[model samples]
Target chain A: MSVTTRRRFAAVALASVAVLAVTTACGDDGDEGGSDGGQITLTVDVFGEQGFGYEKLYEQYMKDHPNIKIEERGKGMGLGDYNTRLTQWMASGAGAGDIVALEEGTIVQFKAQKQNFVNLADHGAASLESNFLPWKWNDGKAGDQILGLGTDVGSMAICYRKDLFEKAGLPTEREAVAAQWPTWDAFIETGKKFQAKSGKVKFVDAATNTFNSILMQTAGNGTGYTYYDKSDQFVLSSNPDVKSAWDLTVKAIEAKLSAGLQTFSDPWATGFKQDQFAIVTCPAWMTGVIKGNAGDAAAGKWDIAKAPGNGGNWGGSFLSVPKQSKHPKEAAELAKFLTTPEAQLEAFKALGNLPSSPKALEDPTLLASKNDYFSNAPAGEIFGAGAKDFKPVYLGPKNQAVRDAVENALRSIEQGQRKPAEAWDDALKAGEAASK
Target chain B: MTTNTADRTRRGRPAHHAQPPRPRKARGNFGTRLDLKTSPYLYVAPFFVIFLIFQLYPLVYTFWVSLHNQPLGGEGEFVGADNFTALMKDEQFWNSVYNTLGIFVVSTIPQLLIGLYLANALNRKLRGRGFFRMTMAVPIITSTAAVAIIFGQLYNRDFGLANWVLGWFGVESIDWRATKWASWIAISTMVDWRWTGYNTLIYLASMQSIPKDLYESAALDGASARRQFWQITVPMLRPTIIFTVIISTIGGLQLFAEPLMFSSGSGNYTGGTLRQYQTVTMYLFENMFTRFNLGYAATVAWALFLLIVIVAFINYLLTRRIGSAK
Candidate 1:
């Protein structure tokens, strides 16, 4: 080949590769929606064990709206990873799905950046307020702008191993177990008694998880807020409910009832298989996680009982449409559909995520439903009852960070690395630092 | 820059001299001259273009964002130097720095020593030397997540191979994630497992290049194998040793994965219950991902970059003194 020809060919190859790279990096555009052959794809971002249990709903929605295709992402993903990615996408003004699921803790953080979301109140959501629980509907709103529609409510319960409870000479039936612990003090006494008879099996999975459940329950019933008040003040040091919950958790740790495992960790998962801990703080959403982690062998060995204190929420999520979505109208419609009373009942059957809708909670089908995994403990009725009594709690923008600080402090005590007093002081300081 | 010029000169002669027998059809043509000047740049443009877009842009942008109070999904206020000033006094930031250095020292020292000994042993005539050399690469080829997961199991508090072995010696099982030193040591071992073989291979390759006659003459002069290893092999592999040392310094100071995976649990960016083994990079991620403090995370990133540069420079100085001490 001629030198010029060879050089030209080489230059052309390099230029093409560069062009290919630039083109590939840009990838597909999000703007293409419902234009080509009247078909469009809607991406839904969700997290946790089974991703909102929306498979049947998605299939039904697509069959109804033939022009729209529904695709869900983030199945089997942890909330932490999902939130981190969602935060990046929100900040960058792109890359987020058309409809994104936000956990209760996450929604509080996103409430500070409410402009990124398409206010659902503008899209007929305000008219549908009576369809949901009062607090559930209000929690979706920032002032008058509604950012999301409530999907599920993580009502509190206590799931204990029936075999272990029987071995420990405690009541194995759900109603009898509920009668054993009517208050936090009674719960601790039960834990101590269980510990005395149960060898190599602790009362609870981790002090931190149980502490958070108690804190949520206490803060919900008493103050109706957590680390922050309605005005978003840092109240960790001043909140009487927080200190009482802390003291109650400290009492459990002092009684040596904790298994010293971090929830959702690998060791914690292993603990389920080996029956290392007799009980775990079970929110309505956690039943799915427990079923998956405990495997088929532990079926019928677990049962859900009433939580010791008043109803509180530890999790649950909202569905929001980002402003960056190319088809916010369609996204809002889909989100609204997924959160309807009928759709929520379908999800309740698929996963134990309790319906946030008051009508759905009162549905005869939902009330009759049983979780075969939990020994047919009337999972629907139990979670439904808890949801009815749960009061909404206000969380601040920096709630997760501050909560992490408290969880770390609790883990420190669980590891036997810090005194309760020292840990409490550090938790306050760390929480303050984290909020900054 | 000088090497590029020298390389052009050296490469320029081969084409010119080798092509002298052929007719120079476009020797004096303008297009040919322009092609000669620009085509070389075109060939190398992709690397520089990629570097500019990915590496240099992010670096400059990081410094710019470090000055602001940037949260996710919001415009940042330019509070110049406030982030840096706060970072200077921040105990968690300082703790991360201290942990980074502690892990770097604890891992790199034993890593290099073991690497040297392994390289020295592999340099000798042994059966199945090719197999042994290839075996050293297995850990490097293994996915980081797989390595982290396996090591996570090994260091687990309740049931782990490490604590199980310790039990044979009548020692109590250690909660690897509890204390600062225990977590650091566990993470350091993970680092060593992955990188020691890499350093060993580098040393082995460099050692093979050294003249074998020096070792033969040393043997004739009544020098033992240990003495020859220290005096002869050590001095000859100074540049390679320094190279490995500098590389390890950079890797160690920016430690993230080992410490991160070592602390299991959802949202576990703190490294431990008390930030015991939280390195600078992990702290950066905690700020960026967990806390959503974009400005603070950028500041942490810049600090980590400066730290790696400073530590790598110090490594250069210390490793340069190795053979010269003779």
Candidate 2:
């Protein structure tokens, strides 16, 4: 080709490249000002069944406020994936939902990076503080700023098959059954008795939940019953509560009280239906899972009792408006509305997520309600009492990793892969390594 | 022109007919002219540009990140070779490397043998030829996640088909995820199940191209079918075998999804309770995502890259030596 033609071709290519670059650069400014006709779409990212009640809540909210549109994105893979995605979005400073749900496990990690979320106190969240439980409300607070609003609290309870208990010659009544195990030692003894009589079925679904329940109970016990201290130093190795919990879990494993299944696993769910195990360490939210897994055939066979030892909290979540949100005010308002007493009560009734709001707990309808799935057990009373005693555990940035390490130790013992002492050493080492 | 005349005189051919080449005019469209010059590069530029942006940039950036102490959401501090130094002392890192190699060996050997056997069977004159060839690709088409989940159930301690089948022969049930060897075996079974059929197709494609006369001569020499296969088919399949080995080695070193899925369905990427089956990729994922240690994760990535390069080089040397010996 001649020089003129080559030069013309180069010019055309350069012009096209410049056009592409300009368009691409323009495309990246995001949907910050994309709203048309004063209408805004707020995206809410959540994980698992925790987001179950939001669709109805969003529909109701949209009906009330026509100018606002809410879009929900859910990851059913559970909290690990949800937290990873949230962290990634936060790190990239883009693609984060207007509002994101943070589980109790990872909320502190997000709270540590306080700038990632908008201070809801600046957007009228402080006025609603009296509506929520003090600990649940405080759990969402970083210093004077509220980063999130409490949604649900997972208060501990013992879910057992009444018929299975009867077969095992144990007390079938909720109060009597709860009376049999006031402490963990008593709980272990009761498990022994049940197993001695009922050879076919184990006492608990999995020892891992028992370990977690004990850990939760001991975590906020005012002593150094924590993985991290107030200064966020690793104290897992020196924590007596952790050691005691490990010992108790080891004892349970040694006694063969566990059905040797992982919680939420397919086998564990199937075991629930087949009555392979008589009991499970149920938090308030687990009642829903149990009911779903048990189906209609096992309907009133299951009952709820007070959890062994002092009360503990399992899973809970908070809703936070990200700083990247286009409409922070609207997102905060939606978050506030979702955690309101009325909304919490409705959610409790529909989804079995125990209310985090103190006023919702005071509501006579919720307090008097019985779960027919749990043999008409007064679940409200049991979980409410548990929630009342729920002390706020100061979870460190690596709480989930630490918890996994401890739980992995318990699992190894349960699987007969390691002795308790070796597992304990392994847990401490792993916990320290992970925390670092 | 002088060189051409000299060459024609040396060959004692007709020098008059060997005239200087005529100048050809630019013909066809702009595409033909462009192809003759440098413009063909423009056609392939998109792929190279994309590769540079996506693959090459991340790789170089990963090496840069490895020199820092970056935590998620925290501004990384420059730490020089500290991350690599820590990796050297990290037991989990070495454990992962060991697990990866163990899984690779267990998976690859059985996969190659079974694939070779299947390919030989498929290359014969058989009924339902098309159907059998198509069936060989079924496993390759299935998603790895689905395969992992299905295999997890089949390897479950109390309820798996494997344990039940063993029970019939009076063998005890094995907790596949609890022990190192058992976990390796379970993960290997998953890897082999997915890739054996794919490798079989590869081998069969190469096997079909081999001259039929070689096998016929062996048959005429009174060699047994098995002997002829060993003598002729195996020798001709060396190149394809080497290619599969390299491919499988690369794939096995980067094994991630099966073990991750096999461990727990709820996104626990530790590989197992004890991390008995945690391959190197899973370890990197655990460090990067779970622990939020980006710097260390990047170090692991670099280590994995170096390991792959070294292994691939050794494979090349071994194959070349074998080819030369033949």
Candidate 3:
């Protein structure tokens, strides 16, 4: 063979290999799926435990439709890492799962980038809107487009140690406990009383939680200032509610009411097991975490009470189908199915995640159910009542950033590194800066 | 083989040069003959191709992104030099720079000193020499993430073994994460623990290469082991020390995982509540992912690159100066 011909052939072969590799690495854009062979695979990506009986629901769904294969990728890391990974995937326009979980704090940010997600309303998502909480349904909507399906709502409650309350000569009854702290100031007063009687035990787990609960309760109230106004201008520095929450949290820290443990830390978990704190600012999902950490030794030692002041929402998540998914229809179907009233109820019963579906919230079976872990606390009713009082707060695009800044400021106070006024100023400055 | 001789003959070889005739075999297939000159280029092309696509492309793209008001997953507006100006005024950027330098000094100094000492000790003939050397490398093989996690637990203010030990001396528990210096010390402990052994191994290899004759002469002249280490070992190991210093400076400037994991795992990327331990890379990661400020993150990346280059150059000059003085 001529040298030039051999050289040309070699170059062509190398080029073809490179091209093949590039194409394969980019992945298959399977725009269509066939039901003829009764086979389709769906991948779902979630952070932490989907705790929502998703595995069981997926199993049930796959059994009913034997042709469909479902693969779930549980990141197990917390929400921050999960959101970061999802954002990277979305930006790169590849390697995204068919369905992804979006936490409420980050949902607004994702909603702003509407091009990355499929408008679920185009695929009959609107028809199921009536099935979910109105606010939750709206949260998943960006204008007319429904970007996600509501999965769970994190209605806030207070889980207190009944034995510890008795030890401190405070009321042990759930109703009496709830009435003692009708306002945040009353709660702090109760904490002081408890502290004077009880030796070293703290009234609350962390001041940061107090800050978040109070902020969520007051941010969307009639006040004109919240994280942002209607025009999306940052109002953190001017927000009266933010100032109040920060001040109250600072008071709690100074009064030594907080145990100063960062939530979900190993020490925090240890605090639960050891009963180091009297009360935990319990979001609906936090019940699972509490129960998991408290173990069998602490069973029936804890009880549920109403959160101080007006009710607030702490956490919740939505299932979003990315536009990059090859099986968009199937993915949408799975997302809708996972969030259905029955599925949501099952999840609530199996995991502690509160149901976002209004119908599921009203289910007699769920309401009648009691948890042995919390002295037979009617968790469903407590969370349901909390859920009812939860108003839909408009979370700005930088909501997580603002929240994190404030939380860090609260942490500094809890650590005794900064005074309330100084930390408050720092927090406001950081929050405003982050908003920009 | 036959083609090379044939080509040489066709090109007219020097008359004085003697050549052996090679017999040509029947060409059965196109694959049988190989182009030796061009084949080496083909063999080494894959690494360069992959490097260009994966490394160089992203680097150039990052520089381009730095010049714009890039938001994640969105088209960026052209805003040349604006991001850089904003970064200059950003207190968090300066804080990160300070924290990174603080941690780099705290970690690298102790690490190099202890590493040098350990290498010197290991160089001595002793019982279980192989075992001791192998054990020294155990921390190096352990994953950085795991090391960070274990160190985090150990540094816990309330429950850690460190505070537990301190309790024996009537010392109150130090809030490692809250205090600026304490947090740096905690993070430095993590960085030092993970890397000291690796540096020890490097120093050990360099120390082993140093002529035994120099050490013997020092010993014969009544010089102590310590003096030998100072006078002969250190000077002899200058180039290796320089290499490790350069590598450590680059690694320290890019310190991310230790501080990230140390500060409550993945949730708190600011490194601490006060960002007392936030490294430059952590700051870059925070802007890129948490804040979704891609342009700012790119700017931080460029700044870090510049810092590393400047520090490495300073190190090169210092090493050269020392070498020349000797």
Candidate 4:
């Protein structure tokens, strides 16, 4: 062969190999991963164990449309790993799933990176906005445009040990427990009574956990400030409601109402099993955690009660289509299916993630569902009622840090490193410092 | 044939000098040397090429990001040096700095000291020396996550083996994650458990390399084992000790997985109930992931880099002084 022709052939072969290598690195979801006729595969990444189940849902959806297949990836929970993994994926603009789950605290930051997610309004997501409650629906809104759709609404409730309550002579009946605490003062008095009767068993997890949740539910989440507003500031320091919450918590500690176990630690779970703690202030997802940790010892030994004062929401998640997704339609359809009333209810049964769909709240399947884990407490009815009255709170990107700082300050008081007054100052200082 | 030879001479090299055919080929080889240098670069360029694209590029990109105000997921505007300025004013950052340093001192010091002592003990004519040496390394091979989980269970306040053991000693139940000191203890236990064995092996390796004649000379001079350890053993292990210190410092400063697992409770990412145990890496992670503040997180990473550089510098100075003094 001529030298020039031989060189050309070698160059072509090298080019082909390089192209193959690039394609291999990008990964494949089988040409049929998407439901649409496009060869591109759509993936939706969500956090928690629910990601596993979503894969099945994706497969089911793909069965109907052979051309479109989905690759579902689960990014582990908490704001730490969630942001890092998602950020890396988003930056790559290739590996990012078609749908990405953005948590409440992270939504603002994700919204700021407007290029990462596809504007659903552009892809017929506008009509679905009205399906959710105004506040719940507004969580994913950066402005007029919606960045995500809420998949679950975490309405807060008190999950107490029925056996512990029974032993403490506090009413184990949900009605009786609900009636006992009409106000925050009444709740503190009840806590004192429970402590007096139960001795060393802690009435709740930690002063910080109890105080923060009460502050949110009673005063409403970030009532004094919105993160977006420059004028909005952390009022947990000077706010009377926050002060009262702190005061009440201190009084509980002084009264020796808690077992003093670290919240979310191995000991904490063991405490639940041993019936060492009476009450756990939980949101929607915590119900599953309670059952998982307590095992059979807690079966038929737990009951649900209204959160003290008023109901406030804690955690909920959202799924959005990234702008870089190859098949936007298939991605949206998959997102919609995963969050549909039937699917959400099934997920609720599988995991205690409360459904975001308002229609699902009225579904008889949910209402009739009884958890053998919580002493056969009507899971659907109790969570559904709270879900209805629950209001969505504004969570800023700095919310997690603020929460951490406040918790640290509270720990200072618990450990006797600082007094409540000093801890309050520290918390405010830390929060302000973090905000900057 | 004469015409072909003339053509070959012209194509292979300039024939200004009339020489043997072998000499002409040798002169042509000089040209091939230049081509080898150029062409080999093309053939073996992928490693350097890929390294620049993936590793070096991201590192430089991170430095670029550090200079800007990037939020989580790259949404924020570039506010030059604002994040750095904010970091300076931020107490949490400073607090984290203290936590990082404090953890380094608390965990790394005891770890090295105990490792040296254990390595010395095992070096003697003892029974089951091989068995003991192998057993010492078991902790080193164990996963950090698994160690953290196991220790988390042990540190449990209600029914933990630790608290139960403490109960036998008339000690009251102490909440491990409630206080900063106790949380550090919990975190340090995990650190100490995982790293002490690895350090011991290094110390032992250095110890085995020490000449027996030196120890004999020390003994002949009537130096006791303790005296020998102080003078002969310690002085000889200086270089190894310096190496271990640097390793421990870098590892210590970047202490993330242990404390993170402790905080998350479920091995998730929440920084414990109190966040008393949260480190700088955890804070950076939280900022980047939980908060989606990429700019803030990048700022944290750069600060960590500077801190690590400063730490490594200080360690080098200290080690150099110690080495010279010994």
Candidate 5:
């Protein structure tokens, strides 16, 4: 090569070395819990856009307590990635949260390692128990110890488009719809009727929602099983109630009541907005989803009725102080304050997250409140009625996996990939794997 | 010009003699030899140091962790080989293995064939060649997560452009995520989309380096385009093909992001409606993250390592045999 060419090559090599040096210098140093000034750097982790509304709430809280400042760390949506990120942070001795949010399904998993979280029973939550529904309260309890405090009660109710129901010549009023389908069988029949009327629309979002709502109500428990008779060996597999629920799901798909869109998808959201489905089994938290997605076009066109089955609790969250927390007392105080009837009521007004506290249900504010999002429906009154009746149930450590397994099995049947019996067997297999 | 070049060469030769560059001592000192021996190593040492710290140490630690029952966040027991034993008996693990191998075979074969074809097509003089090369790399440069999301939307049963196009043939909209095989097709489409261009570029590079004389000779021997490809091009490109195959196989088998993101926005991690699209890497991720079973996940990672090693070894042997036989 010529001398100039060689010189150019050498210069390029030096530039490449410089680039590499710059990248290495910029690599993360793995710092945690850095605070600026008097403000505490509380790394509040939530999934998806959950922190958006909570950001507003925190702003209000900061206004009241200007001395205490908070920072938020939002991660991936749903339980899977959320659990993963939380576990990683805690495992690295990063001390994840002073006041951490725990999904209803994740509470048992977190409580399994009690040392990872502070027992909220120590933080005066024991007295607060009487304020919450038994089931919502037990979500944060392990054995006799309370590790988290419930922020919201996810009481299941069927959300139906009033306009769609009216067009179908079915009852558009909440009370009438609630009375029209006291049982799941009648509900499916009503769905058939609704489908016959609306040529383009479906009766429900998917078969799984219909099946799970009934399952949760009839079982009257958190884990979706009433009881295990022998040595308490957890009779989820052969439970007749669960079997019936599974069968009902398959039947719904066969009967064409379901829209066939996977739940929580973009299509499902569109279905909600367009009222493609006549009924949706919405938990209290779903009020936020409905209001956010359904838009003004759906305003005053929807109302909540009793879910086909009796009142069933579906989803709720808890806030807990981990034992590794530097300021456990302050954390516990924060957790306690977050779940208090007053605070929960405020959250309910802002986000449509029903307060788990029963006292919050009886509050004049709850009784008087109306949602402009749901055709100005008195949503609080409707949800509060069911929220009062939620019976507490046991959720074992493997609850999330078990629920997923059952959901998958039911989905197989619903999607016509397997026969009902084969689906049942699949469920058993999945449950076995999950429980192991 | 010739006279000037000659004068420059003469000056360069005489200048070397006139300068008598200062290196006078020839000493047989141990320190000098040590310095000579170590200096070259020191110059190239960073890679080894980085490889040892980041790659080798983590792999060794992962192996150690695999031997125990380490749950997420460090609550575990030392259950020697129990995780491996459990994995052996685990049906989900076996299912994931089947899915991974299935995806690997399904994705890599088409990717290689299409890449080779595209490389051949592009090797010929063509219009907008620069733009075509740039277009080919666009997919590879795009984020995997973003690719998955776009493909997910395209594969949507209700309103996807794919299903809309299929409607031209009077085909029904397939619930891509609802069935196992359909989900595999969707995921394979994603994998093929991202890496086909990359493999094509590799093939094109190798193809460009092949001498024109070989093809000219083949044409002189009454060879057609087809014959030239099979006889001269294929044989000469064997090593590049092998390299591409091995790389593609490793990537295809470790397919996680496409399936994970395709199956995102759902409550379950079955990969698809029936758990049909769940690759082994996804299984490992689920074990570690979703189930909080880190020891089991580590075992899974080790098993995956062994799998890759065995497959790669077999591939290497096959390639060597082909090369040697030729």
Candidate 6:
């Protein structure tokens, strides 16, 4: 209320405003791809509960390239949310990082806009053909351009809790458990046997995870594709692979063998801790997800078994350079370096992401790798032995959307909202609608 | 000191000599006239400029986008109202509209009634009145996302407090996200928890401004407290009630966060397995982000805007007659 006090307050307010303006002005300069003291910052966009496990690699790369600094985005982020954000950035032609990780299911969607990406083959990637598995290297191509480089492949397995197995009076050893079900039909019978003794706990975490595994395995061996063919036609209604997978999943649901949790959802994570389910159809990458969700409390109770079917994959990603990147050449170099056999092995050790490189798969360290979290199960040989021979399946441009549709239909059946026959009809209709 | 005051008062008797002299009028006339004309406009210019850039530009651009075959990467060929025509027959679009209206009715009616009752209780003299009023605002200030997350945990299927409490009542555990009615009730509880306090504050502010003489004369006429409230307070607060009704109408129809966070996982824009509680905003986001149909999403946005306007207008008309029973 006094003149001096008012003057002092006015001066303080002006000073604070001035400070805010200066900081914000500097922030704009720092963020708008500006160089600071000749250093180039390359942002790499990745997605998952844990990213592609490249922290140590980035630090090593920065040490080698003194002028370059590496930053990562989308660690601890879900794939659905990450893909949505990546679509926005690509659509805007700005805000995309120098390098982006494209999952196998989503890469086809981005492949349509091949002009937005820098072809890796043009950046001396053609000579590195022998570094990756043949099918993985081929999956990265759109026409004549190499759109992405192989990072990791998801070798399928069934991760089960040993403590729960003991409780259910089922075989607790990985090999014995795997031998109990050589086919998905046998797998369902074993599930019923476990359900009879387990009392409260069910056999699997969710039907969707099992459904995806069955679909991918069935498609890989039979049609070499699931919802779409090599010609990129929508084949959801006609594909025998889709129907077989659905029928097998419906059988499991009818038996009441599933815990009825949505995969990667909060309840599913809690299901792991609460011991609500005994098994989940886990690919190599999912081991890391299990450890994260199950937490340290569930340290040695889980083990990995060979998946109940022929060799197949569930999740994997590739690294690529966006054409809009300021440092596309450096980004291409980084992408190439990160997919090397050595780098792939590092990621495998950091997270349980099985490498897509045959050389990495053959390494003694990878072949003999025993994960303590899985009660020292042969995590390596189980996922690695068939890694090279696993068939590759072609996913469509709208595969992610259609897969979500099918998954939703499966969940609806598990929730008892729709019957198995009605849900299949819904899945076909939703998949058709989603493909548009 | 008395003599000094007396001398100052004597000097202040002649106001013209005591005050500072005015500047020359003729020389400053043109400058004064220019300031009078331009200064007022300058003071109000910033708001209009911001509104034009942020509001008007998006409104027009959305309409333009709705007419095109826009994909995620960029604009596609203009197809001229094809998106709107498709939306008319789309079952999913209508499903989302049904959900938004269902949630709005379930949440808003109870919220306003409880808010009015709370306002009336607080308007009276009570012990610890300040503490009670302050606590009423605590839910309002808490972020909606945080509230939804906590409530989401409480409603978790296997181990949530809600299910545990249900067990005590000899009832079966409910999967809140599985059914339409269950998801609606769960989301409605979240909406009411967050916004009831806000409505209470608004109602209480207006209640304090009502003239006291009407209540006093009503009591003098041997009217009971309940009768006084119905006869005097309700009629006088018509405009305030209408204002709250219209505001709630706009907010309720545009519901986004609570339902989106209700399922508590990735890709929850679908709201549930069967899209049980997907609001119009969630559908718009799902079309844009999940389905990558930008033109369709733009059409959905425009349609949602029109819906809110229509619903709010209906609310205005209905509430205008609330106190006309006399």
| TM-score, first chain, each model | 0.92, 0.89, 0.90, 0.84, 0.84, 0.91
Query: Across residues A1-436, which tens digit of lDDT does each residue of candidate 3 receive?
Result: 6999999999999999999877644433322243554456899988763434587898898876665689988645677777888888988999989999888887889877888899998788889978988989988998888988999999999999999999999999999999999999999999999999888789999888888888888874656335886678888877778788777888888899999888777678778877789999999888877887888898889999999877789888899999999989889988989999999998888887899988999999889989889999999999998998877777888888877788888888888888778887888888876776
RMSD to the true structure for each prediction, in A, is 5.7, 6.6, 7.0, 8.4, 7.0, 5.7
Question: Roughly what TM-score does model 4 have, to 2 decimal places?
Answer: 0.83
TM-score of each: 0.92, 0.90, 0.90, 0.83, 0.88, 0.92
Candidate 3 colliding pairs = none
The residue-by-residue lDDT of candidate 1 on B144-242, one tens digit each, is 788889999998889889999999999999999999899888888899899999999999999999898999999999999999998999999999999
What are the per-residue Cα lDDT tens digits for candidate 2 across B113-192?
99999999989889998899999899999999799878988987778899999999999999988899999999999999
Provide per-model DockQ scores: 0.60, 0.40, 0.42, 0.29, 0.37, 0.49
Runs in model 2 deviating more than 4 A are A1-36, B1-36, B265-267, B321-326
Please name the candidate that would achieve the greatest TM-score relative to the true structure: 1
Question: True interface contacts reproduced by each model, as a fraction?
Answer: 0.75, 0.47, 0.53, 0.45, 0.45, 0.59
Report residue A303 deviation for candidate 5 (angstroms).
Answer: 1.7
Q: lDDT tens digits, residues B149-256, model 5?
A: 789889877778889999999999888887767887888889999999999999999999999999998899999999888777777899998898789768877888
What is the lDDT of every predicted structure here?
A: 0.90, 0.85, 0.85, 0.74, 0.77, 0.90
For the record, the alpha-carbon RMSD of candidate 6 to the native fold, in angstroms, is: 5.7
Candidate 4 accuracy as lDDT? 0.74
Choose 1 or 2, whichever is better by TM-score. 1
Relative to the unseen true structure, what is the C-alpha lDDT of residue A181 in candidate 5, on a scale of 0 to 100?
A: 88
Q: Write the per-residue lDDT of candidate 5 for residues A263-315, one digit (tens) a residue.
A: 77666776776667777788878877777677777777878777765577787
Candidate 1 docking quality: incorrect, acceptable, medium or high: medium
- Residue B227, candidate 6: alpha-carbon lDDT: 87
TM-score result, candidate 1 = 0.92
TM-score, B chain, candidate 4? 0.84
TM-score of chain A of 2: 0.89
